[model samples]
Target chain A: AQSVAQPEDQVNVAEGNPLTVKCTYSVSGNPYLFWYVQYPNRGLQFLLKYITGDNLVKGSYGFEAEFNKSQTSFHLKKPSALVSDSALYFCAVRDRYYGNNRLAFGKGNQVVVIP
Target chain B: DAGITQSPRYKITETGRQVTLMCHQTWSHSYMFWYRQDLGHGLRLIYYSAAADITDKGEVPDGYVVSRSKTENFPLTLESATRSQTSVYFCASSESSVETQYFGPGTRLLVL
Candidate 1:
């Protein structure tokens, strides 16, 4: 049972506004989404992916992500929010019946780019 | 890039003792991973490798034990420690196998 869902534990944006961090996935075939960012204790800092062509995918720093294969979802966007872009946000998935490229994380979402 | 490195960063042992967690990567990336970060239960794959002898088992490989012979090291041994294996251990690298995944600077275990 491949899974990844970050129903949001916290999100508050207001630096330049325009941010969204929400991801949804459950795969069995065709899914490779990823977006990570963590800062309080360091580690994790790759911010974008959605393997298999555009549905809007751009990465690093000024992140971007949006791959919604009919609501299976993959959302993590930022038009201009910064305060160093808050922290803690993860949503990952990689599965195809799990052959071992291992990855299925999500239960983290805490962004507070307040000003 | 002096990427990935996870050592004693912080540790405290007790419960049944016997622990070893050290991962080093200088971008020899052939894929190597071992994760465990508890808080809200995220990042939880417990072993992986794709070079140097190869290894695999993820989504929590109970009691953990891994090795990669060589390819920038990959060590994770626990054999007996448990207290839910007090977590925070993370070591990652990638050059393939789905790409971009490079983290390290995590190794905070405490089981007493």
Candidate 2:
């Protein structure tokens, strides 16, 4: 079975502090991972994806994610957290071997940045 | 102004009432998808279309019907609305089978 797991339901951080949101995935073959963010009353926005190549992938809104094949983990990270970065985050995965194009999303994580 | 859009930003309907949600994209993408977002369930797929006439069910397709008569338009219909069906419906489009999906501002529905 292909699936993604977000271990934390909510994470709190102080402004200007570094933050990390953990994600793990299970798949039969190479996994295509993606991160998305949703602000209040807004649709999800694409954050970044790891298909191949570099282990560290950068994305919009000063966010980045690191893909670890050995651990099957793709964790979203930011150097310094901002109050505006507080929102709901989702981790998703797709098995390349299946080639079905459907994604498996984990129950989202809520991040709160306290100023 | 090339992006995905969903009609009826907010809707309120009674039980057993039929409702339709419309989705349109200007990018002419080959793939379109519909998903519902709830409080704790995250986002669940309802249906998708590979092209103008090829449609398929997703993870949670029950109580939902979808038709894609054209490449740019995909409409979802609910034969009988229920309280459990109340959610934020989002429409997304992707250029190909494995690509980044662009989402539209979702439509929030409340069933009483």
Inter-residue clash pairs, candidate 2:
none
**lDDT of candidate model 2 versus the reference:** 0.93
lDDT of 1 by residue, B31-106 (tens): 9999999988888889899887799888789888898999999999998998999988989999988887889979
Q: Score every model by TM-score.
A: 0.33, 0.98
Ten residues in sequence with the least summed lDDT for candidate 1 chain B: B1-10
lDDT of 1 at B48: 92
Identify the leading candidate in terms of lDDT: 2
The CAPRI quality class of candidate 1 comes to acceptable
Candidate 1 ranges with C-alpha deviation above 4 Å: A1-16, A20-29, A32-65, A68-75, A78-85, A98-102, A105-112, B1-11, B14-35, B38-44, B47-56, B59-77, B80-108
TM-score of 1: 0.33
What's the C-alpha lDDT at position B28 in model 1? Answer: 88
Candidate 2 lDDT over residue span A1-115, tens digit each: 6799999999999999999999999999999999999999998899999999999999998999999999999999999999999999999999998847888889999999999
lDDT for position A66 in model 1: 85
